[model samples]
Target chain A: MIRGIKLGLLVVCLAMAWGFPAQPAGANSDMPKPAARWVTADHSKFEALKQDFKSGPEVTKACLSCHNEAAGQVMKTIHWTWLSPDAPPEAKLGKGGLVVNNFCIAMPSNEPRCTSCHAGYGWKDKNFDFAKQENVDCLVCHEQTGTYKKFPAGAGNPASEPKKMGPETFLPPEWNKVAQSVARPSRDNCGTCHFYGGGGDMVKHGDLDSSMKNPDRNLDVHMDAKGANFACTRCHTTIAHKISGRAYKTPAAATRISLLKDDQISRITCESCHSETPHKVDVKLNDHTDKVACQTCHIPEFARKLPTKMRWDWATAGQRDAEGKPIKKKGPLGPPSYDGMKGDFTWQKDVRPVYQWFNGSITNVMAYTKIDPSQPVTLAKIDGDPGDANSRIYPFKLHTGRQPYDKSNNTMVVPKLFGPPGSGAYWSDYDWNKAISAGMAYVDLPYSGQYDFVETRYFFQTSHMVAPKDKAVSCQECHTVDSRLKGISGVYMPGRDYNRPLNYLGWGIAAAALLGVGLHGLGRAVARRKNGNHDHQA
Target chain B: MNGNGNGNKPLYLYTRFERFWHWAQAVLIIVLAVTGLEIHGSYTWLGFKRAVEVHNFCAWTWLVLYAFVLFWMATTGEWRQYIPTTKRLIDVALYYMVGIFQGKPHPVPKSERDKHNPLQRMTYLSISLILIPAQMATGFLYYFYNSWALWGWGAKLTLSTVAFIHTAGMFGFLAFLVVHVYMTTTGHTLTCHLKAMCTGWEEVGVPPKS
Candidate 1:
């Protein structure tokens, strides 16, 4: 107790030294306005929600009776279409297009399994109507009750009846209870799909995980349950159901320097709220705000609460036990290292991010882009350099994997991985030839019969899991010989890099000065002792 | 002569203002070097953030002291004490090297008009006119590195180049400090020059006539 008081006193002294007031920020500000009501009317009293809803679409149909144009606005959004509006025709930059990721390869033949995270329902195949109003799954974003979750392989459907799959049960939410629970999206509403992306929890974006749902200030200052308690939509800010905060419509480092000019720029900028000069006391660090993204220093590292998938190797998969049973091996923290259906995996906790200059635009190899078989293929390459004014240093999760590619065609081969028995799925039959042929034909992409696994590198920008300001990366971390930015080039960093010959010369001259002085001082002392001996007849 | 004292009367060697600036610079330079080296990643004493903060504060203080020192030198004509001259330079060098062992006095004796010998004059002058300014200039540039573009030299200068020059200046200071401190012992008595710096008075062979 005494130590705590002493520490508090010391902090107060330091604060005085730095010329900062000891009081908390915003302490003397005007009293905050009373909490505004999120919804104008009680949702339970609405007659539309009182019906016995049979399916997911029936709930959407009822929602449209009052919200009328919500499905149309949602249909035009990236969440519903899964496509980047700014992408070129050949790039096919999202799920709705020909994009392929190394985790699950292409989603062509795996639509039924992958579409569980889709914003709408009944999108099982190419023929799923995009114009249908009832297809929008409103509960996925609006449901306050935690029970409203979709089926894993039911094409975004919730079970109309109480159905048991494995140890979990899926049922249509009760008409009056869960339907009435609809409100603005909570962290759970977003975390249900995005947190579990790429098949399981903490797989793709290491910066996002289940921990953010109920975070303290240490995990996230803004989204802390005990602190600010911000919802995802606070920054994402929707307009007619279309979210405006797409990451790279411009570059990630794009600046809208003035508040008056904010409408001309994209929504994902921190400056939209914080302004050009955010620092009041240590304005020196504010100079770095232009070249260094807030996340690069604030986050320091990601995947803190859970181990994220760092490496995935499909080559070592499909090994069974002596009795022909599926084998599963445990890894660090009991996360799976090898699954007979998946592959060898590596996981990392509290992983320091790879720092890079990004202008917001990421370069990617399209589904049909031929690549060198000898080199590791680039699934998503961070685009930037030191000279670009639009670029700023950002942190990334560089996830690598080894997945199948056509050896002859020089293009990636999307294998059919998730289907029942005798469906020619790689997981079911473990036959590479049958799976590759079926998947390529379904996606309508030409592929050679022969295939081989190719190593792939993908860079996912980490902008979430912002740590408290006090926990920001220290200057010594980058100013030392060993730095997190060792791989980055083009700009000189002091202490990390130096002019070897000049540095050596500097130390040598200093050493020479010391030696010269030492010898001269010794000579004076020795000569004085000898002269005294002669004079005094010692 | 004794080890700590010379068999002579006391004579004034420095003024009150000169003593203050000299001691202040000595202390400031030491503080700056230690904290600056910590920032240079040569060693860790104070943490990096604290080291940077202290270094900047001391640097600003040194600049203020430097301005005062210059004002005093300019107004009082004390700057002439550091005027380089070649007269008796070789003799002063020889006195320290060989003649000092034979009990020869300093080739250039101290007086009201000549505060330094030929060798000391040149050395002190070079440090005041060149080495110190170089450190101050480079340090100024380093501190304002974030405002390089505003100064319109951001395109021409890189951080590595600035740091390289600043590091070289740091070495010069260290070399001068070692020899300068050691030379204090080579006086009429071991404490003669040391005591002169502290009390602004030196025990000379004969007391100055009033």
Candidate 2:
């Protein structure tokens, strides 16, 4: 029998060896060179670099002289227009200019302050032309000097000269020097705006923060500065100034071997490099790929290095101190739980992700999208179901907050958050009516004259801070009692739960067997003794 | 081995292969039950990861031993011993429940060709025919779950249903084990049946005249 079993195993092994593909010989021959050697064009030698630029457009005019098509390429992008290209036509509110958000409401009346993050100049009002190519700010992304600082209310232009405001003096960056030192976009360039998304550092997407700029392998294996040393562009590969890997739009699955290759790849998913079956050591782990998402196990948690805003209540924005000045409240963590400029806020650190099925499509609520004020509004709905073959479990950061809504119209209301003193902005006058009217008129929407706060939630998918394999969420984390997937339904999880009737029936049968065994034992003992006494008499 | 002392010799009931298979199966079952209960979340004597490892190891061991036992039984004609009969099934059940308390004789006697009584044959048949196959088939399916679609069975049986069936078979094994152990104590002496299993001989009462 042992020899037969050995022979069977040997035949199976031989068949597998004959059927499997052989490993390629030189897998690393095509590895990319270091980023320092990638740039061959010397920008400092160009005559355009010798110009003394007075404003952001002046620098852009110099840049366009040599790189003739650069501005045109940027002009067609959302970064320059602040308008989404594929927004539903009837909504007319897909762009950042008209969209309402839980934090700071709308960008219409607050363009001067909000456009500081925009990659162009002079978006101070509705009159800013979307067709203007000269307004594209190249230094915002390519500046290697680390000195280009766009101040709030600058309308995308860096401070040209030192200026003073409220108790703080702002020093201008050397624009000529910065323009001369342009190179590929570094982590600092992307981190400048994205890291401070919702008015502050680590305020919006929980998975992103300033810490990612130089993360160690312990924090993120892919972007580890000492190991893989991946820049943001490594994954969000760009072509013709169009960056890929936007979470708002993604593919159902990744289908490419190389991220840099121009192929049919899921630009936003981990599967792009890992493939559908990444666990080569354990086939059992790979089997979970159809149902469990890579991030659900790999990410483990978000906001690892900083506390992110978990909740925001705009209704509490008007609170003031004894001196009638807006007051700030700090939570147990170092970050403020409430800022007079914003509202009541709650922050969290090292937060576990919420799991859900996503088919990589989202239907977001537009600015004028009719909403019901009676219940918490889903600002964006991830489209998928448990039954969808294309859908896989994904991790999400569910950001909850309250934003202004028109009480009479039963729709979301965008409020002007920043303006000059006496301009009737919420930050300046603490008046909701004036702010709402100004913001609503800017977007060509009607204000109902009466407004209140309505609870809102935004589902932000986590796609970064992937930990090492040893740090991934363990099997027991989702399989044991009161597991992380506790509230998740539509699928059965062994060890986490069992059929109650089946459990009772098992116990009942065992009890009956024990009862019969005990009674039979007693009867047999008595019968044997009685038979023995009869045998003696015979 | 002590007999009834009515001039009847002890019968050679079990063979060497049967004795080895029985003891090996008993040890494997005990290991399986210990780890199985832990994996089922009944208690935490062994941690979940370790419990799963031990359970899988024992399951594979039992599977290999089971295959060998099947071959042994087939070649030795011991497979016919477990063929169930309804002839005295009710009488044996009655003896256990009520008639035994009134000191009535046993319903059926053991023999070389038909070693098991009616109740023992039916119980063993159910275990070998229904429960063992259920566990083995379901266990194999789970172990190779990733290849379910490759086998063109994607929509047929879900992982949950397969797992439930395996757990149900485990419950059956547990009940059988308890009853089997208790029935061993029903021999002429306290240790009589155990010694018979170990020595391949069962001491019985006086034989009737031919």
Candidate 3:
């Protein structure tokens, strides 16, 4: 017993000398610094965040005290302006611009509801100052507290106090607490606007949804919360808050990033880290990189967890019951199939993506663009073909819809969809002519006073929800008859495409040779059998 | 020369080296045909990727064998043997077509200097000198399709045309194989020609030279 005690004492001494493996920096440390090595300073200690604030703009005023040039920098970004200057001027291509889409139409006469998701405050009209530094909502993106909630119809303003509207009670944030928690944008920050783009989760982009916030490895290998756990700022590496990536108007080409990341050409492409030849040298798949984008093979299907809105028919909207109340019908999936205010909707889960030859650019059909009434309007056209050197096969979610169009003008009409009782909104008055007239007057466009629902097709690129490498599509999926790439033209795939006449001729010759040889052998056998006694060996 | 089978002297129609290459060429051609057809998606036996690798390998082996054959033919003055002859060509054709069924003697038979008959010389010459060489050229062009842009005229060349020519060549080879195999049976006896190919000696029937 004495010897055992002596040995235990020696072991304790050795352990003490070496120091036990570090208890997590917070669990056992006497005093842990708030900021990590990467963060230069913690915002909680800043004097500007110590004061209580009245509004989100007041909080932005405080943030600007230290980050002086931040608002000026943000005003130039697409997120702040919602206008793509890179697009053709006549197209008026962006959210704030006069571009009409099948979903919610345009935002001109519907600012109160639509501007609630805007990065800045009080953008209720065309006169909302785009240059005001205090209007920037800094807490919406950077606040780690996650307490910020914009009022549903408050024009990008969070309530100063608890304000109940409909079913949701918008709670006012503790301004000091939210302001103190400022940092870089997280996945939740970007998801606030992007995930709920078409007014609900998984409504706009099939690849983006609330399920992506903390996905597992099976859903996305890169952004898996438990694995890589990469923040949005990781690949969308921003400099001066410009957020170096594509815009509403797609870029015509992708810039290759240097391996060291010092080249300043960070384009949020798969090639940013994975070069053009991602597969190892001599691999057959490596050769396909030139013709096929990473997303085409990596993301087999999207909306894995949630069913996304696939189609909407605005023509079937505005049905009321005997009591004059709005009607709603539940879909096969969880969401409502028909809402009296909106229309019929089709939702799909685990949807296979459509493919296109994309050079990164697209032709957006704007409100001013002329249309043919006989056919479905192509809202956006992917601009590339197999022959284009910049082109590669990319995957997309092709959403089809029917919305208001002008029969007289041969152009799409933006309907006033969201407003109060006297505002002549389509949802309120249930009148297409009144809503179209109000909407056309707001955008300063002439109303033809003729309205009809025309079918439209819109395409969104599938870049996220990338399944694991093991779940990628097999070779035979695209290389066989009735293949996934069946409708694609301008290139010949071997097993999928065969020259029927040449094949028939080649096979015919081989068959004929066999048949001829067999017949000749049979004839010689018959001749020998008939002349039984003749010795004709020579 | 007139009565080859009746010659009494024990004759050797095939040399040892010639028999080796002929049998080797037959096996190589069969391998190339099967793998080449598989690569064309005729059927999925051996799969696509394996078929291409194997086809290329067999084609290279055939080319090497043909190169040695060319060198041997040049040095030994045996290139003259493949020269086409109209001498009794029609008679030989008629013999195979009509007379052979009636048990008439062969119009042209294997001899010391002319193992290949008039018809054999024409068929073998065209196949070895024309068809196979054309096939090899197209096969190589198809294999190096990715490098087409490097060549001035190659950019204008379509893969479909190259592949079609190569596929047609495969059919030609297969047809040749069927007819050539059947013709081996039309000798003096069923097994005599096969025996000569194997042992390099022909047993000239019914007499012994003195």
Please state every model's RMSD to the true fold in angstroms.
5.9, 7.5, 6.5
List candidate 3 stretches off by more than 4 Å: A1-37, A88-91, A163-168, A248-262, A322-325, A534-538, B1-3, B6-92, B105-133, B152-154, B184-210
User: Candidate 1 chain A: minimum summed lDDT over ten consecutive residues — where?
Assistant: A25-34
Pairwise TM-score winner, candidates 1 and 3: 1
Arranged by lDDT, best first = 3, 1, 2
Clashing pairs in model 3? none
TM-score of chain B of each: 0.91, 0.89, 0.93
- Model 1 clash tally, residue pairs: 2
Encode model 1's per-residue lDDT on A489-525: one tens digit a residue: 7766655667787768877998898898889878777
Per model, kept true contacts as a fraction are 0.42, 0.31, 0.31
TM-score of model 3's chain A? 0.91
Ranking by TM-score: 1, 2, 3
After superposition, the stretches of candidate 2 with alpha carbons farther than 4 Å from their true spots are: A1-35, A93-98, A164-169, A247-267, A519-538, B1-8, B33-50, B102-105, B203-210
* Candidate 2 docking quality: incorrect, acceptable, medium or high: acceptable
Pairs of residues clashing in candidate 2: none
A144-256 per-residue lDDT for model 2 (tens digits): 88888887678887776787655756678787798998988878888888888877788888988888888887778888776676778777767667666543344433443
| Candidate 2 chain A: worst-modelled 10 consecutive residues by lDDT | A22-31
